[model samples]
Target: MQIGVDPGSRYTGISLFTGSDAVSPKPVAEPAVVRAGVFSIEVQHRGNQIREKLTARAALRRGRRSRNLRYRQPRFDNRTRSVGWLAPSLRHRVETTMSWISRLQRWAPVAALHVERVAFDTQLLQDPEIAGRGYQQGTLHGYELREYLLEKWQRKCAYCGVSGVPLNLDHIRPRSRGGSDRASNLTLACISCNQTKGNQPVEVFLAGRPEMLARILAQVRKPLRDAAAVSSTRWALWKSLTVTGLPVHVASGGRTKYNRHRTNTPKSHTLDALHVGVVDEVTGWPVRVLVATATGRGTYTRTRTDRYGFPRLRLPRTKLHHGFQTGDLVRAVVRTGANQGTHVGRVAVRSTGRFNIRTATGLVQGIGHRYVRLLQRGDGWTYSRQPEQQPA
Candidate 1:
């Protein structure tokens, strides 16, 4: 068995397969995909929350120290970050991907691992037309970034297309939302257009003008944050996979694309993962993908804190209540209650023995514990299935 991992910042696609024809003399059937799906995580949002808490904590400390409350030596250089230290959220991405790989290995007779070295090649995607030309800096022709934007955008507002007006460089994705300062994310916008679209994502701002939206985005690079996240975590993920002692075969994004195009495979996260290595033919993939999202084992803090860090609400120290812990997948068979019938989902436990089951349709609350039966113990992930993507 072999595994192909198409690692992304937000969603890492993984496929477990068995290569059939590699050792066969005659033409054998295609590789069989035992399982495939994305491992999802909200890296940016989680990182932001961590940074916010650190900043708030520092502010509170500075406030008290400078208030003449106590005389303490200034120790600004007391600590230093070790080499290769990634932020908590980005680090989580690497750790979680590794954790799932270990789980997958247990389920299959995995022999080798084919992992993409990098998710995107900046040079290849600057322009769709510039393919095979070996263009590095795109179609700038030695002009500056701002000048390039002005000319590329035809000196007009990309959103409104109002020419002959004072135009400002706008971010298709706002900086606050983790957008980068790269040229691809930059565009020309008039003063009115800029303000009207202030801090709002380009997609939401141009919802009414989809044609205009598509035109602007076509010139833009893939979302900068996602690219950055994948780039930052790629090396770390690759390094972790090496310790597994499998013959880890690294592949480039271009090779994955080439294999996918040659095989006429439909574009999907799981499919991309399946096509990540050197291959002649591709087939026999499962129709359904098992989407495993990393929800994390519940937080360590039992007390909810406010902005000032004061405990807003305190809960029982124990996470498990009434023999059911929060996040346990369960089936509730209620014979007589407002939430009658059967419901299957992750449960939110309550001390009163009345839990809430979040199912696919909706939340069924006030479910008695006696009616609930544990289906699977939640190990910090939620699972679902979706049909494989079809070709356009």
Candidate 2:
């Protein structure tokens, strides 16, 4: 069987498929393919874990430098980064994807690998008007425009100037009032402002604040300066996949979307993986898609450290305590307490006999390990829900 993979920063989609002669050649025909199963490997902490750690480390370093200003000599010139050095978090994503592929190879005879190399064309996305030679001359490209807007407006609501709230890209002129989605017409506003100004033109909504309205208009007209193109780590992943010796087939995001639409499948990472390459129409395929969440295996370090790098927790001396390990799916039956009744989720083992159960509702801490029963040993993946059964 051939395996299709769609790798993302947070999740990797995997699909096993066979029977190529089933799909009709016509685009309008009902497209179908037989698949044993499709699933995703969801990174437990996502990329934020790495980011948070880096931020904390930086803060600590800054504090140390300030305290030891005389003792610590500045060595910025001596420190140098190696070529093609990826941040630890991003490298983790590539490594994790490769690890999943290796594991899958053991279970099934993977004849080939299909992967989506690039999801979007950065140049075209940034400058829609630049075609042919204009593409070469276009200054603003990719994420720079978005970054510019965020910085230009000071990451606050244009109307209210409220900071530290969730902001969204908003249109100055309502679409209903003939507004365009161009960068010039776009601005960042807090959720409250956006909802309140819904379907209203900028002038009408900002009538009370003439000075702010003027500032907004002027800022929108001014284009952001050109910046260096930001490179993505997906290219690094592609390079690594090439050395695996397996026949790797590359596809584009456009083709994947087209195949998915023709098949009339719902939007999902796993389903997208299934539609990564050309497929012939088939019949009687199972409708259910497996939603596998990644629960990391227990790390080598058992202790949890504090911000000052002091040991705060020694965890459990034994990795497996009472036949249970951290990340194992468990069902806790608590007879009485504030957290009573049945709670089903992954459990965090403790040497002290008390465990933490992470459930769908939330984390129920301080549950005795005896009350927990192992439902499934975490194999780095958990099928918590099916696509059809997802909440509307």
Candidate 3:
């Protein structure tokens, strides 16, 4: 019998399997040849990548050929491909380990244990074959959790109670909205549901649907109860357990091995292919943007769709921005081309050699002095901030 226990501090799942009776039968009362594994683990993590490297350039490019013609190339960290540094903090790892230990102590009695391993990373995150690049920081952990959850649920969603292809592990709360990697906060959702929910709160999507919420709650509750029923002494009965290798390598190794593994580097990492979306003034819908890549150019045209797809061309608009005229009562909205959709202000009052803008809403009062822009005057506004300004 080979039994695997997937354990976490907050949650634990157990699975038991027997080899053919002819091979060996230390059969427990359960007669089924293959039994489904229960999932009851939650991996938790904290810190996140905050300030990422934008870029760094050489002080001077190839100046000119000298008599000897020697050249000095700019140097930077090849792993990150820039001169910047990555300050990886420990908010995620500590919580995950805590969850694993908590589950291991609770659910050992009923489930037979041959080898117990915590899979923190998955093939996509670690396998050089799939990921040609260097060890991406969270690749292993993300992949591992997905694989474990899929297998445990027999590739079915824990919610919706549907089984077929494995469901993706989705966050009940979106990470973008300040959710941490807590197991208690994760759930299995179908691909359709996952995409639809995207970075939004579960409650926001569920939106007062009581029946749907009940189903999802039932799936999570059952696995937890089963795991808790097992006794600790039962787990002690298992013969052997092994901790699986984490996909991410620790920083203990010297720079020699680090350099060797860091062979895969892209020719150049441009900010191209960066998807920037904006609320379209014309359509009243979110519009995809295509920004020009030429240096010192902050112009972006709307993306156009044709036979194949959007052919990486400019978005055409009748109004072109030639710097605002003096006292135009212009809306000094952030330059979309240069600022990349960051809004500065809704209305900026022209002052002595500077735009004096009042806060549009109460929220604007708290923002610091900088980053304010004049609002782009739409069809309605004749005077920028005049009391008469109203919708057409």
TM-score of each: 0.67, 0.63, 0.26
Better of 1 and 2 by lDDT: 1
lDDT of 3 by residue, 348-368 (tens): 222223443333342222222
Model 2 per-residue lDDT tens digits across residues 156-239:
888889987778889898889898877678889999989999999999998988998898898777644221111255677778
Question: lDDT: which is higher, 1 or 3?
Answer: 1
Off by over 4 Å in 2: 22-45, 76-83, 123-231, 279-286, 294-325, 331-344, 360-362, 373-383, 389-392
Q: In candidate 1, what are the lDDT values of residues 1-392, reduced to their tens digit?
A: 78888876556777877665444454575543333322321111134445566686789689878988778998888688998788777788788778878987897788888888764445434553454343334332223345346545767888888997788989889999999877778888999999999999999998998998787777664344345665778888888899999999887665676667767776566677888767777656876777776666776657887887788998888888878899999998888767779999999998989899999888888888989999999887777777776655
Residue 327, model 1: Cα distance from true site in angstroms:
1.2
Cα lDDT of candidate 3 equals 0.35
Best by lDDT: 1
Q: Tell me, by TM-score, which candidate is best.
A: 1
Query: Candidates' lDDT values, in order?
Result: 0.73, 0.69, 0.35
Please give the range of 10 consecutive residues that has the lowest summed lDDT in model 2. Answer: 223-232
